[model samples]
Target: MTDVQRGTEQASWRTLPGFTTVRTYQPRWLSRDLVAGLVLTTLLVPQGMAYAELAGLPPITGLYTTVLALLGYAVFGPSRVLVLGPDSSLGPMIAATVIPLVTANGDPGRAVAYASMLALMVGAITVLAGIFRLGFVADLLSKPTQLGYMNGLALTILVGQLPKLFGFSVDADNFLDEAAGFFRGLVDGDTVGPALAVGVGSLILILLFQRILPRVPGVLVAVVLAIGCVTLFDLPERGVDVVGPMPEGLPPFVIPSVPLEDFGLLLAGALGIALVSLTDTISTASVFAARRGEEVSADREMVAVGAASIAAGLFQGFPVSTSGSRTAVAAQNGAKTQVTGLVGALAIAALLVFAPGLLRNLPQPTLAAVVIAASLSLADLPGLRRLGRQRRSDFVLALAAFLGVALLGVLPGIGIAVGLSILVVFNRAWRPHQAVLGRSEDLAGYHDLTFHPATTHLPGLVIYRFDAPLFFANARSFRDQVRALAAAEPRPAWILVAAEPITDIDTTAADMLGDLVRGLHEQGIRLVFAELKDPVRRRLDHYELTDTIKPGDFFETIRMAVEAYQASTGRTWERGPGSYEIPD
Candidate 1:
């Protein structure tokens, strides 16, 4: 290739998303980006460290992760205003995956290594998925399931943080155990009065500001006030834990390397984490993209998030995902592009280098309070209530997912959620909705017999509609319905399938149809199809079964089929007395 062409090709790949945003940078948006960036840093610092703590990592690692993730996403992420960082949802998953893997002494460094490795693996998985255009994997968890999982997750986080909030420690792992341990501690008088005062005061302050001053960053306010209170009252002497001086400067770029045995476990956790991250990112991106009048490129987003994950992992940080709350804050503050993220990252870097002790006096319980507030936002009881009122089936699915997460550990909960979602999809296809068609005097087309029971049908013909594709799972159901139609009193001369909804016919279904056709022929009944899609017809022909279905059995439309049937049988449509529906 010529040098110019080579350079141009390089430029094309480089223009994945973020760089294009840079090239087309608007001068008018700079001030807005700067201000929004500064405003975002307020939440970024506290929440990042708090989430890091939540994930069983050093608080400074959260800052490192936040900085790298933000900078990396700015270069690759398609969404201009989405804020990527350590998230509350991912924290529990990280802790669940990494904490147990640590040595008996609970090596902090080993935990960091495992988490960073997980981030790397998650990044690789997401990037590969994006490259293969597997972005639709994000739909693995349906909306109801997602809501339930989040609610369960919220409860888990809230309970897990309660011990910290009450100025005590719990020696339990899972949510149930932790809840029991927390209560036992409460009864044993583990609560530190002064520490509880600081924690509750911070929690109330954050909640009050969120409720009364929605625009203000309540987390930052709470952090500042809690630090002041701890410092002025010398709360550390009264049994309150605090974050001390952070490690100076940025972490050098170095990949986290863990034991080979841990690779399988880390990768497993990464798969679940990657899926959740993609689902969370795509949902948040869609909302922000719609608000800005842009279409969401989910694949690009997955790749971007992957890049961000890799960057953070290399810097000894855990996995990151888009924060909808943070994005909303940035958008509300007039953020125009990733420049806001750049500002936030740089500000955090400055804090690390210039003032590592800024939050030294901030109480650990205050951080717990920050996490509790975030967890509160994750629950959606109103959404669950709506699901219950809207449809019982949907409510059941949501409730099942909720129970799965609440009872099982976080990683296992995700597995159960995915499994339940897949089962729901398979059940729909396994026993699909089938309808018998009859003519209504006032209607334009044939109507479902179940809905319009008093409609008319020709005496010797039956029209059946199966509302799903013909596949291995539902093929038997379809055959049984057809057999039932053939067995009716004065058995139908023809059983015509309204094939519009049967989008595809798989090989197993094709063989089933072939056998059914031969059986019906012996019974003196002809099978006919109307409104069949061309692709499906092609598949039937490929199976060499179309020729066996009689020369003139297929018709372009239901009307054409009716006309042919009427002409051949010399019969007109008959009116049924009272209600008429399929016997079985």
Candidate 2:
């Protein structure tokens, strides 16, 4: 390439967040980033390995995935302090995706290959979604359902880790079976005392340190102490399992070539993974970015996430997502830029290259303890409780989601959450909130008649408000409500609709409106509209329903509509002894 072309390319590279951060790098911030990165690296190693085991992959891939993901996001991601790695939330999901495809023959290598392929596909999906500006896809899972799903997932992970933490393996499928197996084993005196003590002790140490010393790396300290204890006491002789050291070096960069027939299944898994990953990334980006008084472009964040996944996939790693705990750790330690991520990535890489056997004596139960501790953070029981006490419908939705995940499994739980979201939206729009409006003495222009029971009402005018877009599903309800308003005592001369809440009008609704207009005219009653938006007006014109109502029937405000009614009918509303209206 020519020098000018190369310079242009370099200038284009400046669009990347990491490059910009480097070009405008501040020297004073370097020390803080260095220290924060080192601190973050301590959490990354154990959590990465633990989450990998949670995903049913070998421990080493977690470290590999973490290094590559951090490096990749630092280059392309929008948020500077957001950390990416193998997340506990994605662990069961990754296992759900690849284990079915790999477990038949019990080949660990085959599981790795399927997971890598899954990551590549997930990357492709997220990148395309970003390029197309489809960040709204994250809304597929609503807040209540997401809470329910996470609660279910956390419980699942906690239970699954019980066997490992107790120093035994229980062969089971699904949450119930796993729970049953654990309890059955416990009853059978199958728990190894030494392993249980180490695991439970490690768990207690991590949780206590987190609560007592928020700044310390509890997982690192617990791992160190456990390893030392194992080494000093030779705990392996007591049937205690250790993670053993990772492979000496990173896996080679190779495109995972899986059986073509598995593509269909893997693609299904990828879609679910991509959705959860992007939703999580977007939410995290919003939070951490808000802390610094900045906003993150969701599209750019999605692209960055895709790049991270692809980077990890090439190294035979699994799906990864942002870790709120690790990011908080970095920020707490004064991370100033993506350089912290780069520094952390490089430091982990150095460990992999130089001291591959650093964790050789790391007890497997300690790893299980790490996972259990992380899982505890994933649940939000208070949120679930608040939901239950706040709204009955939302509480029902959350309960369904929780049950779906607990009984059905992780992937199906996501499917349930998304489905529930769609249903709730439809239910709201279909029934909606309708109100009859009247002028009250204490209120300003108008108020719901249900609340202002004594408000003044004009003898020949009725004002109605429907708080939803006019769509096919609710057209008939609108028709019936208007007809009921018109049928009330002594009948009305005009029905004036408060159109501000009716944001749009579909063809079916327009047709229904035309019919209502004709019927009102036959009864010598006029139909009128006020505060209709221009877009809805244009839609009415397109539907040709404007031809049904005289051009004079439309008003820009309720005041104007009321004035027109008084001018034509010589009627007015005012506070009186019984009725607020005084007929002229």
Question: How many backbone clashes does every candidate have?
Answer: 0, 1
* Deviating ranges (above 4 Å) for candidate 2: 1-15, 574-584
lDDT of 1 by residue, 156-264 (tens): 9999999999999998878899999999999999999988988888889889988898779988888998999888999999999999877898888887778898788
TM per candidate = 0.97, 0.96
Pairs with backbone N, CA or C atoms under 3 Å apart (clashes), candidate 1? none
Task: Judging by TM-score against the true structure, name the best candidate.
Answer: 1
With candidate 2 superimposed using the best TM-score fit, by how many Å does residue 165's alpha carbon deviate from the native?
0.4
Worst 10-residue lDDT window, candidate 1? 575-584
What is candidate 2's lDDT per residue for 243-269, written digit by digit as tens?
Answer: 876799767998898999989988988
Runs in model 1 lying further than 4 Å from the true structure: 1-15, 577-580
**Cα lDDT listed for each candidate:** 0.90, 0.89
